[model samples]
Target: MGRLQRLSSNACQRLARRAAPQPIIRRRVTYQVAGRDFLVISGYEPDGQRIFYLKKLVRPSLQAGFEFVYPANRRERYDRDVEAISRSLSLVDP
Candidate 1:
C-alpha cells in the first residue's frame, strides 16, 4: 500500500509538470464616475478568456462586485462590448 501511494504521488507530480501553465495578462485603469474615481482591472487568460473587475476607489466597501466570463472565441466581441460599457458608465445619486 505504501509503494502504491508513492507511485501515485509520483505520477501526479509528473503530470502536473507536463501541463503548460496559463499566462495572465492584466491592465489597470482608472475611470471617472459621478465625479469620483473608480479602478478597473481587465485581463485575459492564455486561452483568450476575458475577465473584468471594477471597484470604487473612494468607498470600496460600498461597491458591489460582479464577474462575467466569456468564451475564448468571443474575445473580439467581448472587447468591443466592454469598451462601450466603460464609456457609458455613470453613477447616479439616490
Candidate 2:
C-alpha cells in the first residue's frame, strides 16, 4: 500500500474504535489570528484516499470567503509555509 492508503487504513481503524459510541463522526478545529482563519480537517476521498489539510481563510464576510489549503505529510513544513504565505497576503478590489 502507498502512503495515502496506509493513512486511510489507520483512519479507518480509529474510526472503527470510535464506532461503539456513534459509528460516524467528522471533526474540524479552527482558529483566527491577524484576521486570518486557520483550520485542520481530516477526511477521505471517494477512492479511499485519506486527505488531511491545513487551510487559511481570508476575507471573511457574510457574502463569501476565500481560502487556501496546504497538504503535506510534514506538519512542520506545512505550518511554516502557510504562515509565510498568510503574512504576505494582500487583497485587491475588483
Candidate 3:
C-alpha cells in the first residue's frame, strides 16, 4: 500500500479535530497522534517512487516547529514506513 492504513474510528475523529491544512513546504500536515502533535510529509520522484518523512512536533504550537527538512539521503525511509505499517497492522511482510 502506498499510504498508511486507514485509521480507526476514534483515531479518525481525533485527527479530524486536529488536522490543519497549511501551504506545501517543509511541513505538509499537522495532526495529533496519541494526543501529541506530528508533522508528516511525503514526496514522489519522477521515477514513481514514494517516501514519507515523520517527525514529532512538540511545543506551545508556535514556539517550535520543524525547520526546513526533506527525505533523508538514505533510500530506506520508504522501506521503514512500509514495514512498520505491515508489522503494526499484522499484515504479511512486504
Index of the highest-TM-score prediction: 1
Report clash pairs, candidate 2: none
Best by lDDT: 1
Q: Report the C-alpha lDDT of model 2 over 1-94, residue by residue, as the tens digit.
A: 6465445888889988887676445433334333344433433333333334344444554122234444435556666655675466555445
Task: Report each candidate's C-alpha RMSD, comma-separated, in the order given.
Answer: 6.5, 13.5, 21.1
- Candidate with better TM-score, 2 vs 3: 2
lDDT of 2 at 47: 36
Clash counts per candidate, in order, are: 0, 0, 0
lDDT of each: 0.53, 0.47, 0.44
Candidate 1 residue-wise lDDT, 20-74, digit = tens: 6856654432222343556655555444444444433334345433344566477
Instruction: Give the lowest summed-lDDT range of ten residues in model 2.
Output: 42-51
lDDT of 1 at 87: 67
Shift in Å, residue 79, candidate 2: 1.2
Where is model 2 more than 4 Å wrong at Cα?
1-25, 33-73
Between candidates 1 and 2, which one is better according to lDDT? 1
TM-score of 1: 0.42
Which residue pairs show collisions in model 3?
none
Misplaced by over 4 Å in model 3 are 1-36, 61-78, 81-94
